[model samples]
Target: MDTTPLRVAIIGGGVSGLSLAYYLQKQGGEAARPIEVNIFERKATLGGNAETVWVDLGNRRHPGKPDSPYRRWADLGVNDVNLATYHRLRTILGEIGELERMKPLENTESYFSRDGSIALTDDRELFRGVSDPAHDLSQVDGGKLAVLMAVVHRSAIELVESRRITPRYTVDDFFDACVATPAEMLAAAAEELGVTIDWQDPALPARLERLRHTIYYPRISAMYFADDRGPGGMPLQAPFEYYRIQEGGSPPDRRYFEHGSQHWLEALAAHVTDPSTPGPRVEILRGIEVEASLSPQGVTLTERAPGEDRWEADLLIMATHAEDALPLLTFGDGLSDTHRELQHILGKVRYTRSFSVCHTAAARLPPNRNLWRTYNIEVRNPEDTFFPYRIDYVANRHQNDAENPAYNQAGLPQYFVSLVDDLNRIPRREMLERRPSPLDGPSALAAAAPGEAGYRDRLPPLDSDLEAKAWTLFKHNVLDADCLEAQEEIARYNQTTARRRFEGRQDVCPLLFAGGWTRGAGLQEQCLEQSAQVVELLLGKAERRADPLRLVPTGSQARQRHPQARSFTSVPTGS
Candidate 1:
């Protein structure tokens, strides 16, 4: 029997790749052969989307402690964690001893029109003093509200049914099939209110146009899809399931890590590399771009740079974005038919670029401070078909100590993160360089005057008119219908190849994939689940007690457990 260890090389160091390394080392002890894992990340940092940056609050001091400067850590990319749906992620946090670090957050939102009209707000306080707040539903009229509710109900029903039937349908396709037409909405409204609505009314077309722009278009482009291009664009598409998993549940039990998401990512890296742990040898290679050449014998990996040593691995696992993984497979040597087929499937996946700015930009949020919520979305152009410019998260309320009077003083700046489609909207001079700074004490801040160079260097901009703390740019995977179909094809191919190898076939595919792109909505949960499946494939399933992964209930099962639960709706509130 050959007892030599299996050499596995994994590319990309995002959540999916990091989780794969952790699981592979943990379960390798029980496998038929020991394993050695190598992870190569192009970036210096491990966390991909989970980036955290600590910002200086300038001369602001902690409440009741004048000697201490006020500072906080903010997540630039991935911030909130939905407890109800993130089962695998929670388990991984527990295994790493970071579960208790999660803090609950009140998930509230408000939407504003470009002209600063409060289109909708879920926070009840906004209507505390107003009688018939429903009458204050400015711009959102009876016909539009009726259509929006009908669309939401129909879309929810279709999302539940589409899992079994038209799984490849896009949100646009589902809307066309299930949602009522504008004419139908008008007729229904007339029948319900015992009044006639003339098709020739000059206001009718404008009302219907507002319904599409305010309700239908923003729901698809701004919120769910998160793309600048409307659903008609190829690379900006989202499948039915993508929207279903996001908006299909009751108000998510939202939480954020105490120290930020990168803390747990660093913990996972530490767990895999700890010498005290009993697991396979794991080597993490940072700041290396690897190219691979495959043949019938094995995989040969070499640094993209010249004069670099080439390493050989028996198996290769690509835990990267589908498009990114394709370029890593080199064609210097003749390629196998199976490898070509894999590349073809991978090419089907698509992605779009977006910018996230972690700054103190009050201009991005609603002008009226009273309408603010944890999530404030400003529609810069409500009439436009695509409305993607909005402040996505208010970090001060979501992650910082909002009750601290010192931080919320009249002159102090509030932290905000805006998701923008146009990079030019973010002022470049205001963007702070990306670098971690040590926490400065109050004495350090008081050492410098307002006009001194030391004060400018040590403090973040005190007012929104000045520079911001920091900014970051990232890409989001587009989960369109074509991408979803590609995922299914990859799964089928893997299963068939695995079976052939089990039957003692000499010719077998050596490559496997693990990433959010390989499964459902591209989220942390899907990324972790795919990693666990890869581990099970390499090493047989572990004993029940030793298994670190557990099955998360399906959406229907979760609903069954909470029958009285109201399905959470992001639909703008109005008449």
Candidate 2:
């Protein structure tokens, strides 16, 4: 019997890569031989989109307290996790013992027009004095609001129902059959709700247009789907089933980590590296870019750094964005047909760049403070209807001690994470000052006597002016029709190769792929799910399944399938 450990190389140290390593170490314990896993991350940090920074509240501490300015953790990238839908992620968190750190988030939202007008708001306090009937309506034309709500309701129902019957249904079909036909929509609404809707009202068109630009387009298309191109964008042709799985059921019960998203990511990293772990020796190589070439025997990864180190692995798992993965596949020796095909599919996956800024920029929120909610969507340029220019998340309302009166005092301090397409909107001075923490722990605050000589030296430089704090630019995968199709194609290809190996075929490619983009909506849940699937295949468990090619369900389906069942063993397996 072959006693050599299975050698595996995972490129890209994002959530997918880290989680893959964790599971590989975990499941490998049950195998006859051990597994040797190496994770190569080009970035200095482990987490890709999950970035957490310590916000130094310099000198803003409560009076009479020596720890005047305390520091708080804020997430610049992926912040909130929906407890209702994130089954796989929740399971992984439990295994790592960080599930207890989850805290509920106040996820109220408000939309604002470019001219500082409150177009729509969920804050009841804003309409406190208005009549009871008026208070219930958004700050828009009553007819327009009614029309918008009716369409949204009908469309959501249709989307869910259509997805249940037809898996290939796209959002474009939904728009054509349900949304674009306003006459039919109005008639159905009037009949179903027993309310009169005047389709012929002279001002209806303009009012509907206002609602589209201010509320519907921004909130639904841009914020929820991240389709900045609006109706004309890729979201229109994307599969509706994915969206239903992500946002379909009831409103998601959202929560954030007490210490920020980096907390759990760091915990996962620590778990894989912990000396107590049994079997599957895992090593993390940081700041190293590797070029990969594939052959029948295995994969060869050559470091792109000074030493140009190289390693041989029986299998290679790419846990990176498709575009990023495409460039790393070198054809120095030769390339197989499957390798060229994968490169072509990966090349088709598209990405767009956006800036995420963590700052105290109150100006980015609703001008009228009364309308501010946990999330504020501001339309900087109403004419540019593609997407809302800026979205500011009120970090204060969701993070540590948010309800404590001491921390809520006027002029103390506030933190906001703004997502914007244009960096010029932020002040130039605050371009890039603070660096992201090394994911170890919070950066220490300077604790020196105010008048002491070493006071200045002790403290890290604090920006007295409270505008922009820290910013990071990220590339977001554009989940349009073509991208979704490519993901399906890749999944099919992987399954085909796995089946070939099961049938004792010699020409199968040993290369595998795992990432959020591999399945439904590219969120943290999908990232973990895809990674888990890859581990199952590597462990030879795929042959036991009834359908080896079946795609794992995510969101609600995942919740029902798992039901608090631990996917991996809790005990330390091998050393």
Candidate 3:
């Protein structure tokens, strides 16, 4: 007699959900055990916040290939994949036979607009006086201060790695363990590493402050949420272990898929759904919003479509954002106290809004001839009247690819650029819906103008050639104090649950959580790592022929690394 296949249901079909499905399918194929997998995505498309839409460059630009209209694919959501720290992502790409598709980003010289003169940055000269205090200060370029900051950053990374510490629990814990301020963050590491720098330079403080306002502030603002109380809405936390090199060096050159980052999502979706595979085939249901109720036995998901309105699974994985996933479930009385507490802990994360606008126009890019194909431009004024965030350009990557005989056969438009709006001054949906013009509207510059921090027109005037445009908005929580508290609560809960399980008592949930927001510093690589962990948990249970969704560690140190990570910590069948 054949055993019934294990049924697994995943919510939200973004990278996390897809990753779980991919691993489950792999397990079923190898173990000769049937595993049924289903992904329900609310959006019409599969990728929750990551999707691709092609831009028709119009037949006018195609010339002899007018029949093809020079169509170019644009990523509406999700951009580059950092190769150095994204171990799980790289592994997945290799497994799926897409290793060669990884393309490194070309580093171009960046510019900072200041005092009526645009200052340029050459990466080579960035560290000119980094070790020597005798160098003439007057000969330095724009990124001089950045070199010192880089040393500080390196020190922090090494400090964490040397102690074998991964502080995913809380920013407070991190700050308590490591040095507090940004300036002294690397003090311990610098001494150990034997790197020399003039920390006592007379002009160091002013230069550091300048770097903060001009570069770091805008970067932090973009990556985090706006805190009117101060810039501390999200506190700096230790970087993830996987994000740094073994030697505790800087991040590697970023890479992207030649076809666009969305290709990974599409490929995973295709893999699990391929019917030719040996194990139970994976089923993907798009354009479906589900209402789920959890009981001791399993999960019942309710939808609107006929025959698809309901689903019962032995395990339910909430792979969507906490805000979106929490509402879909009805935590009935049947749920144990452990599970309920887990819910409250997961919900503590606060997500901030994000906005990105992509447009095809040469004028949107900086007019500087020395600028690289990809670069960051920060607009500022002489009197420090407006401190606008850095706007990134993506035109050079597309143009450089046009040289390859394999791409752009139809001669697509040469320029493509995108700007990620700072949290303090996100462009209104109305403002982005129409054609973007000179920086006169309520954009970065306009919003910062009244404050008189600094001022400058970041981009050249928009001309008639602004042919195509697109925009996307989403929410992500920065690694702030609240996020740290959530991490701490979850860690404690997991430890308690683990002890109960060891005592042969009934405990833990039949659910697993996987997402960037779930843990590990909230980045794309973390999402992949979390998903891999879910797979390890489930497969370990399978080896023991135990409960379908038990949160067992794959290795000795696996569970210890993220003790509070199992979002689904209660098992109804236990006890």
In the range 193-270, model 3's lDDT, one tens digit per residue, is: 565656666676566565454544444433323322223233434232323521122546466666556566767677
- Whichever of 1 and 2 has more lDDT, that candidate is 2
lDDT tens per residue, model 2, 1-575: 57997899999888999989988887889865678999997755667777666656556544576654455667767787876778888888888898888876665667776575555565432321222233234434643575566554544444343223222333444444433445553454445556566666666556555545555556554443355565334443243344444444366656788777866886788789787887588888876789988776788999988899999988889898787786787543444688678876776576766767777767777776656667777654746655633577877765533444555553446777787777668665443334334344522212211111111222355444422346666566666555666776777666776667567676777788987667655678778777877787777665444333223333554333222223222422111
Alpha carbon lDDT of residue 441, candidate 2?
54
Task: Provide the TM-score for each candidate, comma-separated.
Answer: 0.76, 0.78, 0.71
Q: Report the alpha-carbon TM-score of model 2 versus the true structure.
A: 0.78
- The worst-scoring run of ten residues by lDDT in candidate 1 lies at 448-457
What is the Å distance of residue 53 in model 1 from its true position?
A: 1.7
Q: For residue 232, give model 3's deviation from the true position in Å.
A: 4.6
Encode model 1's per-residue lDDT on 141-227: one tens digit a residue. 754455444444443444343232233333454344223343442343344445455555566556544444454455455443354
Please give the ranking of all candidate structures by lDDT, highest first, separated by commas. 2, 1, 3
Clashing pairs in 1: none
Q: How does candidate 3 fare on TM-score?
A: 0.71
